[model samples]
Target: MNGNQKTEPTINRKTARELELIQFKSGYEDGTIIAQQQHMNSVLGAISFAFFLALFSAGPDAFSKPALIVSEISFSASLVSNILLFFFYKTVSGKKDLEYIWDFEQTSYAEIFKTIALFAPIIGTFSLIFHYSTLAFIFSAFIAVVGFATFLLAKNQISLRDSLLSEYRLSLLYAGRDEDYFTLKKHEFKQKPSAEELKINKYDYSICNQKKELIGVVTLHHQAVVGDIIEIADSEPLTVLRIIHNERATKLICKEYTEDTSAID
Candidate 1:
């Protein structure tokens, strides 16, 4: 037995379809969330740019120097973060094919820029409003703390949901063979079973020639009946000659069907 040739659990056609549907739904939801976040970032970028322009036009005397500088820096940071995130989303989304879902959580750049973009505007606005009075500034700081805590809570919830969905999709991917169906076709002939002692299971099949010469064993999940033509591993197409059933299991007797073999048959 080949050490690498491990058998996979068989999934019926109906169960496979169900797994496929579940995978599709999970991908769709993930894509939707990504799109929503992209849209939110775009909107926030525009708002931050507008505020930056307004502050710049207000001149040095319109607000205290410290307040003015901090506000300008905050808005600029938010704007830059949003722009970087926008391009990141575009580049990542464009490179990926439509076959797989976008996993945003996998990229730390995305999370960092998104968080900065989301909260920078709030910080800038509060700093500008409460700049003049110490008491007002302290109150604004308390409110900002509460808001930041709320945002963290919401972010945690979203992360938890994404983690669960990712795990579920991974389980479904492993449970079904759809992802590796074509890869299985390239399996090499491993072991040949003896004619006197043949074994038939869900994944392993024994093939023999008409004279009971043991050919090679192939892994097949479906039942092989007489007259069914199947290409075993790297061999030519072989026609099933007969099926022998004993108390244990059934054995397949096959022969290569070529022009010469056809004439002989």
Candidate 2:
């Protein structure tokens, strides 16, 4: 049915909580890294432009045609990278809500900038090395190595997060529905609920099956018998806790009530 025919009976609450927390933490780190990179981009862009201006101020003979070409390309590429980073950051950060699903979409754009940041330097450096001295080559080489390493690491993390998200979504899709519960109106009281009875003052109910034992609190709207099974708007069978005909909704005080499954049966 509805593609959930093979859905699992239930998910382990502890495991689910841990996974959600891990994703949240990773998302936070991703945001941090993006902010850091944005600042770096601005600084790098200014430096690149300054270098370009300096080359012109040196006059035509300052560097050979080939050298000038290489330097110009490197500086321009660096400048463009900075511009792209600015736009990327602006777009992603503009959104106020940061849901888990939205993480993938945001990170994908950031990843593109990361790729450009990684390659632009390498290409620029290699080009410059041909025109400049051995020192240039050494510097470019170092930047290339670092950029490549950063790219690889970021790629791996993105892949891992994507896999985790996929698993989580699939689990959510296939999760099976268990029994639900509801409360009844106090006015409909067939017999006055004893003072010792755990009354459902709010929408929350302490449901059980046949025996009077605690199951879990289920939120619902409407009135029904305390021990009887009733179907709510969702069509799920829920055990009734306490009935309420016309009462003001009060702050929910969820005190666990004990009952056995056999009580309902």
Candidate 3:
């Protein structure tokens, strides 16, 4: 009976250890996925920011007014979407429980935002090209198609090569990492924008209620004309009462909008 009891406890211990290892493996896989997603977001954000900066630096004369405006709006949207997704991933990964991390499924909104981040820059580029010259645009389009096809062909070849490699060799390639290799290092989330980093040249809109009470401030990253109705988060739609422009920033003074507001001369 004592021998049987000893054996039973040993089995229980083994089972517990196995379960712990399974949990660890699951967490590591999830963490790896999150890490990959974060990296993708970083790349998209950088591309979007680069395009936005290029457009801004080119001033108003690089392209036709309408084309330039569309490109700027598209790139800005992409940049904002990428930034939001990066923060979403960071928030999910910051949870203490690994199970929570595994349970976290990205929403459809995230997928939509990611799609925008992926294609908005391309759209913006094409818009500018089309505005400049049809022949140049067509040539650029052809080159883009060829480049994408080549990338796919190269990727497929690499995948086929990797498939033929033995599991032992693959394992060896992944081995010899430090203890924290699978662990994701914590990232410091910046809470506030630095004084030097402030975008003073951008337009910011301030929303107020009917009583002239301040509601909130928003940066639309685009031009806001007077009498335009704009939607601010967690608030009713506001109408642009006036636009105040200065050397540093442009402010759109807004108030709660109604149908009558538009009728007013």
Candidate 4:
């Protein structure tokens, strides 16, 4: 879907079914895995900040020092990676509600990370070997920290790509994440599963209710790991937010059904 496209109240079942086929919620919560991602991101930010502090504190003396080949290479790699990030951000998801994600998604940021990771250690080793280096220990330290940060980021991206998170979709019927609406089969819902029957932790899942009647299913981000439902709403994000206030967030998301939806699958 386009970044500016209007979203549907109920997503089609196609995406949901496809995701299920791949066993989306079988093993672990995506959020659990994403926590590690956040850790690497925090470290990367720290390195950038530390490097600048070192450069500023030393001033002209820092520049008078000779630059190492690895330092030059790392700088070049950083520049290219940043440029790629700019282009990718402008292309994939431009000016949208989930724009906040663009901050973590630094575009070819993954690639930049890998480049730095691959080169930083080499540079560090070279610096230690050629200890008669032109730059001060602070400069070498900055490169070491930045390189380690990049390595961590590269590892995270390579293994965990949350393809289905924060994506715009058709509706709950087609929800792949927790907090989507499911079309209730009259026979099964007749039992009126208790709230506990519906709540599944470690992974997102929701039971749909209308006027206290079970009519559908919805997968909720009770955790809000990715973009929020508010980002995908048509009338108002509050329309959905109001759901959490009125009932359980999932209970508020109504399922699709005809008045005579009595048949069971």
lDDT of 1 by residue, 119-207 (tens): 89877887677665768888888887899999999999989987886676666668895546435434634766544224433555678
lDDT of 2 by residue, 29-123 (tens): 44654566668778777777777676676477446567667777777777888877665665666335334324653587756866776566556
TM-score (all chains, Cα) for each model = 0.40, 0.38, 0.42, 0.26
What digit string (tens of lDDT, one per residue) describes model 3 on residues 99-213?
5545444366545767887788778878777766889989999999999999999999988866654453455457854333323223324467435335533557666555556
In model 3, the clashing pairs are none
Query: Model 3 has how many clashing residue pairs?
Result: 0
Which candidate ranks first by lDDT, i.e. highest?
1
Error of 2 at 106 (Å): 7.0
| Candidate 1 regions with alpha-carbon error over 4 angstroms | 1-30, 62-64, 90-104, 132-135, 145-265
> What lDDT score is found at residue 223 in candidate 3?
72
lDDT of 1 at 251: 71
Cα-based lDDT for every prediction: 0.72, 0.58, 0.70, 0.43
Candidate 4: regions farther than 4 A off: 1-33, 68-113, 117-265
The alpha-carbon RMSD values of the candidates against the true structure, listed in the order shown, are 19.1, 16.9, 25.7, 16.8
Better of 1 and 2 by TM-score: 1
Q: Which 10-residue window of candidate 2 scores lowest in summed lDDT?
A: 177-186
Q: Choose the strongest candidate by TM-score.
A: 3
| Clashing residue pairs for model 1 | none
